[model samples]
Target: MSLCYCNSQKSFKDCCEPYIKGLKNAPTAEALMRSRYSAYATHQADYLVATTHLSQRALYPKEDILLWATSNQWQKLEVLKSTPTTVEFKAYYLDQNKIPQIHHEFSTFVQEEGIWYYVDGEYR
Candidate 1:
């Protein structure tokens, strides 16, 4: 079975694909963060953009995101702390130069009409 990009110990199809495919909405900020990490791994740039809060979408134009996502080899994701509308996490990956890297961030989320959206993140 292909494990999820978030390393959630579940198959990709059983984990993030549904969110990426628009089959369901992420239930919380942490869940949205996990699915977004998976979207990067799978090169689903559109899903990444679509899930972002509209006010924040300008920061992640699809072309730029596609370029970034395709350039890295995403390794795994760890959820450090999660609240009702925020999540702190670490995403591990290898850059194009093959250097190991970790993106640690405290992210905020907003939910509207029962759909969660990524708002912004602060690097740590």
Candidate 2:
């Protein structure tokens, strides 16, 4: 089995697939963050949009999200820190021009009714 795109050292089916597939909810902010990274790697734009907080959904249209996800060659994810409501991480990828790039962000998340949704981030 292939390893998860999140570099979780576990098989995709075991690590993030269930969340991406909508079969399960991510239990923590960190888990949601890791699964979101995997969604980018797998080009699952719907998952990304669905997991975004509703108030911020308009800020990230599905088309834009799809383009961003498909334009990159996702490499790996490095989670720097995780708290109850935040996750700081670096996502490495090759951009459209095939240049290596890093998207670093300290992301915020909110849980409503036991479901975690991405709110926004402070890019660094």
Tell me, by lDDT, which candidate is best. 2
TM-score of each: 0.97, 0.99
> Cα lDDT of model 2 overall?
0.98
Residue-level lDDT of model 1, residues 48-79, one tens digit each, is 99999999999889999999999999988989
**Cα lDDT, model 1, residue 40:** 93
| Count of clashes in candidate 1 | 0
How does residue 77 of candidate 2 score in lDDT? 100
Most TM-score-accurate candidate: 2
Q: After superposition, how far is residue 77 of candidate 2 from its true place, in Å?
A: 0.1
TM-score of 2: 0.99
> Which residue pairs come into collision in candidate 2?
none
For residue 16, model 1's alpha carbon misses the true position, in angstroms, by 0.6
User: lDDT of model 1 at residue 77?
Assistant: 91
Model 1 TM-score (2 dp): 0.97
lDDT of 1: 0.93
| Candidate 1 residue spans exceeding 4 A from truth | none
